[model samples]
Target: MVAAAEVVACNEDLITLILLRLPVKSLLRFKCVSKKWLCLISTPNFSSRHRRLASASILLSQIPGLISHLSLNCSSSEKPFSSLDFIDDSAGVKLLQSINGLALGCSFHKLGKPRSYYVCNPSTRQFLTLPPPNAEGHDSFATVLGVYLAFDPSKSPHYQVVCVRNCSLSAAHDRYQIQIYPSETRTWRLCGSPFASPSDIMFETGVLWNGAIHWISPTGATLCFNINQEHLGSMPSPPSDEHWSKRRFRYFGESGGHLHLVEIYGPSTTQFQVFELERDYSRWICKYQIDISPIVDAFPEMVRDYLHPHHHDSLFYAFVLLFVQETEEGSSLLLHIPGKLISYNLRNKSFKEICDSGPKSTKTNTALHIGCFHAHQFIETLASV
Candidate 1:
């Protein structure tokens, strides 16, 4: 009995060491093996260690009903795409944002009907549907601009869902209102508004960084809401030569634990300038200026046949900058051009095409078709809502 007890203790230690190196998805499944394994994986220290070793993946959601997952650490050829079958097909679900391994999704319904919101862990297939926000009378879908999920399961088991809406259209009568629903309380309450007057917050472009949510305003300024402080703040956006009144094509993202903004410019939209926010949140510095001429040069025949004729001056206007994926190997920019998705490496100046089975334009004559697709950085975790 003494020798058997010694062997069991030795096995448990070895098992824990092996499990710590594995991914969260595998650990979640292994939890069902025994009660001991379940308790070990559920510990806070084990969760943090697993998160640190996990690599971020990209979650792509296509209109109507399709969701694909791609790993950022591996090349396009090496990683196989996996579809998310757990999400209900009939819900007409649209992914809003992903944070701390939980994705916030909303299911659309007919007009005047309340939309259903869900917080789900794609890896674990665990989900929680949030109760409807207490909005009286004005229950139309148009009233709500955006719903963002703000939760870090590492800190606490509870999560918060924030809803931004135009109060004028609702019964509130305020220009804009911020409502927060805490999972612990299971109730919705109005929070403080960030903007002084009526201003359109780019909720779709909002990126969570440095314990706060950042969004680009129409007037070339960044509006921030600190998750820890629950306060509003503003920061100056990158200085641009273009007029502030004009719509600027830009995206907010994070790479290597730092916030970055990618601004697309030039006649053909071939020039991509990347700016990284300083750690102090003081100013932005130019990081890389990538030229897509090589990619354009690689496919000369297609460019000349399709692009030159339609866009006489701007031959590369079909290409749109999506987001930047930074890894230990290097950083690459993801671009969408017509039916293809291309990844351009900033370090070696190499371009690789990512196989996408999403929707494409049937018309061969058109240079590009802006279809309905969304992509975001995802980290797999066992965090519950």
Candidate 2:
């Protein structure tokens, strides 16, 4: 109890230990306290250690152009922080993918310039613009399918970008090729030879898990690319219904080191099953049967009024799953409705409104569709590109 100043001066090592445990937002504010404190927190060693122990938050977007962060441990009254002000041109930015703590964003074409990509850390409000992929001649014939990001901070501080293109030469032909850009090299290189793929595969909505980028095909096939090995492989998909040709995938993502897939076979039903991939990549096991009957009962607007027995897809456009959050208490499903965001607990079967839909500018006029809403995990980190 001598004095606060004396205590901090006496135990600089203890102060460093405490700073690493605080959230990044608090650390950012504390930097102005003293010059010595600022120097200690800005070191690469401290940033790496803080990132390794930071808790993850969910970054959700109903439309690709808008993004917001949802803290799992926060109360319902705490509205999710929604803004892209860190970007100079926020209106034209679309977040394509997120891995670990870095977000992969694409800036739409403006003026006479072509589209540009950025790898950013939302926590630190820092970003690095990336050069265009080196797909020279294929630009005219090939359609840019998607750009995916691969990063694992626990293994290395660097990240890689994977650009996929649909190079189908003819109607009968279905071909695809991939180019990878590593941060260390800062140049895009063709990973392997062109490969064949199903025409129905949605490569744009891929997710990174277990050191690989995974794409789930609607035709009951899963495609994967090993970033480290540069090998193309396939994984087992969730059980499919042969009669149901138009199966809708509600979610395909990973949380807490677990990969999950959700499919709603019947459009009018409020019941669905969530499947988790086994660690060894053998099979998908049915982990949870989610019944939103109670939530739907409370909010009747979730079901459309087009009454018809033959029309089995009346409730298909009611809601979209934004995130599947895993925690020590239990897991919860974050969903988006017409104008609200709600969380439904998987274990207790209880539902509550986490927050209202964000600002009007962020809202889109398009009808709800599969893959319309996305939620990616954003772990706080100071790692720069």
Candidate 3:
């Protein structure tokens, strides 16, 4: 082994190429192998190259307690790692959003103290605190609706946090405003004048895609905020009939630089279509047709027959669409079930269990709804927080 190492180490070019292909965890350990390896991997250029080529893994968080890492590319039995443990547990810190490899965390407000926002790289266990939004007298009454992280490592290492808040003009009229915190500036600034957005829209669940943050409302209204131009705009969602007016989208997220939306029109159905937003915001194209009837046949527990009559809104009440992997080879879906995470290939229709949640499922125990869990794509990087 020593002789083999020496032979491979003879050429720095070959050594660098091999190291770049290794996982971030393994590369960190390899750094201690020799000073040469440490110096090579520690360089900014090497880190950037590794980050660009790294495959993304989904980080599943079930609020105050559990956080599981699910890798779609690698078929390993390695246990999930707790990425948010570095933050103080007592602070009631909850992960709001994660982009690239950095996570945006929000801590609950104490008695007199204001809430806190943190940008952290879970891989490095490094974090940075963000300044509070500058709100004067009347604006002080505004409540934060959602906080989102926009970090595209492929574009730049620096990140930006977009905070959407609701401003009340009266008991009848409520307007919304946006505040942005760029890592380069380290201060919060209002993005644009307050505007009236669609009612019943979940602003807090904005998905960053194609240089913009997009939010799809239950009423089928879609809004996007461009980070570069600092402009708010609207986009088109997938076409729907009267039966789909309620939306009932299973997932709306970005993966592999593409925006995807999954809306299950009817209640007790096992089939759905995945839509991809065009780069030009022209229209949503049907990317994949998903039919999980075979999975339900195999895992009878996934059926929603157990739900009470009142709660029987959908057969997917127990299934959560965690992550979707779009690759050149094919596409696959990662779904969160009761006690395990199942990966179903869209191309071949094959499925397998990727991660198990032990005796008591963390999400099932904590979340009133079985589908309630936060999932973010994590790409391992040596980038600084």
User: Top TM-score: which candidate number?
Assistant: 2
> In model 2, which range of ten residues has the least summed lDDT?
75-84
Per-candidate TM-scores read 0.83, 0.87, 0.85
lDDT by residue (tens digit), candidate 1, 1-385: 9998667666977777789877666787898988989999998888877777776777666655456665543435322224334666454666777777788887756465567778888767777877766565566345677677877766777788877766674344457667888888888887875344336557656777777778886667668777668877876677675644644645668766778887655446556678888878889998888778878777553353344566577454556566677777789887666556677888888887765433443124335545455677777676766
| True lDDT of residue 19, candidate 3 | 92
Residue 7 of model 1, lDDT score: 79
Roughly what TM-score does model 3 have, to 2 decimal places? 0.85
**Which of the two candidates, 1 or 3, achieves a greater lDDT against the reference?**
3
Per-residue lDDT over 307-335 for candidate 2, one digit per residue giving the tens place of the 0 to 100 score: 66466555444788888888777899988
The CA lDDT of each predicted structure is 0.69, 0.77, 0.77
Report the C-alpha lDDT of model 3 over 52-107, residue by residue, as the tens digit: 78776777776554677766655464542574767764567777777777888877
Q: Per-prediction count of colliding residue pairs?
A: 0, 0, 0
Q: Which stretches of candidate 2 lie over 4 Å from their true place?
A: 21-35, 62-64, 75-81, 89-91, 109-113, 140-142, 167-172, 307-317, 355-372
Badly placed stretches (over 4 Å) of model 1 are: 1-10, 23-26, 72-89, 109-113, 140-142, 169-174, 193-198, 243-245, 301-311, 355-367
- Poorly placed runs, candidate 3 (over 4 Å): 1-15, 18-39, 77-80, 108-113, 138-142, 169-171, 306-317, 355-368
Residue 61 local lDDT, model 1: 69
Our model 1 lands, by Cα RMSD against the true structure, at 4.3
Give the higher-TM-score candidate: 2 or 3: 2
